[model samples]
Target: MIEFDHVSKHYPGGNEALTNLSLEIRHGELLVLAGHSGAGKSTLLKLIAALEAPTAGRVLVNGLDVGRMRRSQVPYLRRSLGLVMQEHRLLMDRTVFDNVMLPLTISSQPPSDAAKRVRVALERVGLAEFENAMPITLSGGEQQRVAIARAIVNRPSILIADEPTAHLDPAYAREIAALFRSFHAAGVTLILATHDDTLYSPYGARRVELAHGKLLS
Candidate 1:
């Protein structure tokens, strides 16, 4: 459902983050992006999400060219995507319910319906009882679960997670990995960028590695 055609991304001062990186991610497929820091994995994800424009080439999501889409059109395009960053990005001052409700609120979903969806998402992440709790009071693993819940609350078709298990312990990392596996099995197109090979390698998903901004053969 996504394609990168000769895509290259360059930041300020002429630093190239990705170089001619091309790949296709099919619907309902679970893909793993494995690489060290500065290997272009995060840049690739941002390109797909339209958060960063490609300096050259094109990025297409569900047949629509993201690189060519209008700024106003981005929100509509992103409605189908669920993004989880390395940082939890939770609102520490807000309750879990409110944080998970943000996406739906942005979309102007009805309150009654949004609440039900948020409850389901929290349950999926095994945080059903913490809906009224504050983020600061939760454990690291619990906070990550809250982030996951917030991402998927809208029931997006594609899920992209960047370094999701980076700060968690081995057990919590495995828990998060297993949760992602369940989502994959349920037919969500998943692309996870992680430096931890052991966390996802056992899933036998198609693996793509990058080195110095280029895909490794």
Candidate 2:
């Protein structure tokens, strides 16, 4: 379970990203965050991954206080979480297979096992044949698929994305949304921050809107 207890995040120059917000994300649930560009949606998502710490209150994920965890422990905390963003963040120089295998390279898993897992993840995303291709060679939607494949290579329990399908056409956006639905159907916890609620509303996702750093609904 993920819990945010009256969390508030303050940045320098009097910028407040989030304010006294409290939320709970139960395991195996798909939740959508809908809001305008600066509604703190991204800030809330970052708190889960420990990319940013709260100025007040605590972020607890599976019983660990993320805001208070030592820097050395952040990576361990991230192992259970998969993150995708608007920017694919792929290494243009690396092949798709290598990019997906990047996460496992840091772990103790053997090379053959890691390679197998990477191929499996790519297959799940329907991109097994493109493993040897480069990110730049694929279309926008395919590049996003590669990013998704890389994210699930470790089989994270929670998958969070920030505006993942924002740049795609309607058809491709639906495809990506369906891909996310497949992951959720497999029992992965999904927390998505997106402007287009229609992408997941038909699937019965619970959505909470944020306005000016506070929950509006």
lDDT of 1 by residue, 1-217 (tens): 9999999988999899999988999999888998889999999999888999999999999999999999999998887799999999999999999999999999999999999999999999999999999999999999999999988998889999999999999999999999998999898999999988676678767889999899995
lDDT by residue for model 2 (40-91), tens: 9999999999999999999999999999999999998887788899998999
| TM-score for each of the candidates | 0.98, 0.98
For each candidate in turn, give its C-alpha RMSD to the true structure in angstroms: 0.8, 0.7
lDDT of 2: 0.93
Which candidate tops lDDT? 2
> Whole-model Cα lDDT per candidate?
0.92, 0.93
Model 2 lDDT-worst window of ten: 100-109
Q: Which ranges in model 2 have alpha carbons more than 4 Å from their true place?
A: none
